[model samples]
Target chain A: MTDLNNQPQQPQKEQPGDQPKKSELVEKIQQLGQSNVAQAPDSNIHVLPIIGQVEGHMQLPPQNKTTKYEHLIPQLVAIEQNPKIEGLIVLLNTVGGDVEAGLAISEMIASLSKPTASIVLGGGHSIGVPIAVSTNHSFITETATMTIHPIRMTGLVIGVPQTFEYMDKMQDRVVNFVTQHSNIDEDKFKELMFAKGNLTRDIGTNVVGQDAVDYGLIDAVGGVKEAMEKLNEEIDKRKPDEDEQVIQ
Target chain B: MVLYTPLSEVDIFPADQTAYDSTVITTYNQTPVKAFKLENGSYQIVQVLSTDPSIYLHPDYQPGMQFNA
Candidate 1:
């Protein structure tokens, strides 16, 4: 007996209006709290993929010029400054690049306080040798190969006595650094650099992952897992004591 | 045939060796310079300097002029 259809229609509550009001309130709250919130932190571990030639002084040959020192240096510095980044894993798949550039990069890596590990995949050759050995610990895939060679100069050969002297000094710098960082001795490295009977065109030794390990150039033969594990171990070693009181 | 003398033997600088700077000029003729005399009586070429003052010779070449070039 109630005429439902004839009943006065109650004012429909606008659900859409409530949603917009709620969104606006949320937006205002976010704006008010934005200044108080700290910036998002960096990751705990940074994995930098260094592919192609490590462009230093020499321009990489055509078809292999992806990575360069200019790009790598800033990234490394950023990683160094980031407090959350406890360690670094450099994934190297380079044929090598400019000597001074590679050396500079390697020196930076060697000097980092943070634990660092490098994994050489594909092939790490020429100047790549220094980078491979720069990290605290190094790993190379079983299929990976590293070419150890004497420092070479491209372009014109003045053949002047001074030019030869410069070459010698530069080569000596590279050799000393490599010998100091790696397990290979200076004499053996020089032999490898000047090895006349092995390679067809170049004078160098090609060491596979295992061979590199045996020569003491690389720490072990492994892949991504081993590299990460080593990096974690380094991080764990450097972890600050939670019980210690901060002087600041 | 050219005869070469060690920088040390020629006494080009001085016997005392302190007063003399021992600085020698060099050219780019590929001739070896004997800086020091060996026990075997053979002179060892230390370096060859450049003919031009702008160019410095390597430490491994002889300093004096040779008849070969």
Candidate 2:
């Protein structure tokens, strides 16, 4: 009978490329253990960049390029938790992605205790508008443009009453969020969102930076300097009066 | 949960006609207005009013007025 318990053991060997130098392996492990904490002072405001598409939904197919909110949500929580972080500056330059993810991010920023400001760079289109205005104050580059449009679905639309009702409810939620955060009136925003003769093919209005300011969609038509200054002012106002020192 | 309402419904706007000359007509106790020139050689006037802090404040504050500690 074959001895089942006495199995032959194979000799252990490492290939030339597979064997890393002892120091190199130790160094890599050490680096991996180090945390990548942002080192901005508590008094100094930190800028968190939220670029690219906001990702939502599980099982993201290859065709669906989205901005992962999981990564962003933790970063936002970190900003709120960090004692050294006085304020947060959100720099947005996105071609808008997932709606639920974007809205979730916006709500998080809006509810943060720290003074937050957002600057819309190249463009703050679609769901980006709510995020742009979600901060305590918001600014856009003079050249930046914001596209105010209704919610859209990329997949096939079932032409059923329930489908239409769901779409309407979803749209209402977005519109409510945007109007609540920004100065844009809901009716005018709706008009722009469903404008008949704005774009030849699209069903929305593209407001440039200054126009956005005029429409109350954005606070100012300025860049980094203006946004930072506003954020600092808000932060200063929130600080305890006893701790306030007059700066020359 | 607090239901969300549109600002347009809560806020009021001016409703008056202007003469050929570019002068804004206003009623007593009306909100101030800021005027801007549109691209089509037409002027668009927007009412400038202070937003109630309640609109944007965290729910811990009073129902009306700006949130002041």
Candidate 3:
């Protein structure tokens, strides 16, 4: 790499007579062949995309596309401490995974002092619902969908009364989180979760775009443009308060 | 321990591992990206995992563009 750097300089110096008319544009064109694109200042609103399956404590098989919680947890911490970042945008397109991990992420986003927004694209199913609502404001693209469903254990189960009780307790956590963060009430959300005939052989409603907003699950039925505008507005709203604190 | 998803268990956990090994998450010019390993030992950009929206607009960083390993 250092040799390549020297090579470019060497050509300019040695062929100064022959290439005297080699314009800066020509130089740029030559450099463009390489991977050296000039960079701009970092964005104040950092994006955290929750794509594919949200993998938690158990590592999904290698072939499965996963958004690892370990990577995200640290990133969230960095976002909190980074003075350069003023806002967060959680871009969600996930078929939700572990309950605990999803809740952990949702909690983290909800607690962040900086302005935060989430945009649900494709499908923000199951646990993704909580995460989508966790932000200060949320958006869902017109074609996007959100699956509201009850939690279920996949591995071996004892199949006892206590097991059902335990599952209900876990379900309550997700229910509580989504309802608390968004505008949907518990009864309505449960109705959607347990609704039948919507999904073939499944018991959930796949709420699309405007339906999500109508149910009060998401703030609006818009995409990136609206999300950016809302985030900037919230950022501006908090800026004055932060300046006051700095003065104090 | 509970899975809260509309997707089946099989879809979430695939049987094959080789398919996943072909791609890796790495940093290019300070921006983190997921790239596919080419047969010639170089990697091709599959996704740019950066917060800077501008990074996505750069022609050089677009998907299918190759960079040296």
**Top DockQ prediction, candidate number:** 3
Clashing pairs in 1: B26-B49, B32-B62, B33-B45, B33-B62, B34-B44, B34-B45, B47-B60, B47-B61, B47-B62, B48-B61
Best by lDDT: 3
Worst 10 residues of 1 chain B by lDDT: B50-59
Q: Which stretches of candidate 2 lie over 4 Å from their true place?
A: A1-43, A58-66, A156-159, A243-248, B1-69
- For candidate 2 chain A, which ten residues in a row score worst on lDDT? A33-42
Model 3, position A166, has a per-residue lDDT of 94
Candidate 3 clash pair list: none
Native-referenced DockQ of model 2? 0.01
Query: Highest TM-score: which candidate?
Result: 3
Give the per-residue lDDT digits (tens) of candidate 2, residues A177-239. Answer: 989998989999999999977778879998898999999989898888998888878888877
Give per-residue lDDT, candidate 3, residue A177: 93
True-structure Cα RMSD, model 2: 23.9
DockQ for candidate 3: 0.25
Candidate 1: C-alpha lDDT: 0.67
**Candidate 1 chain A — worst ten consecutive residues by lDDT sum?**
A33-42
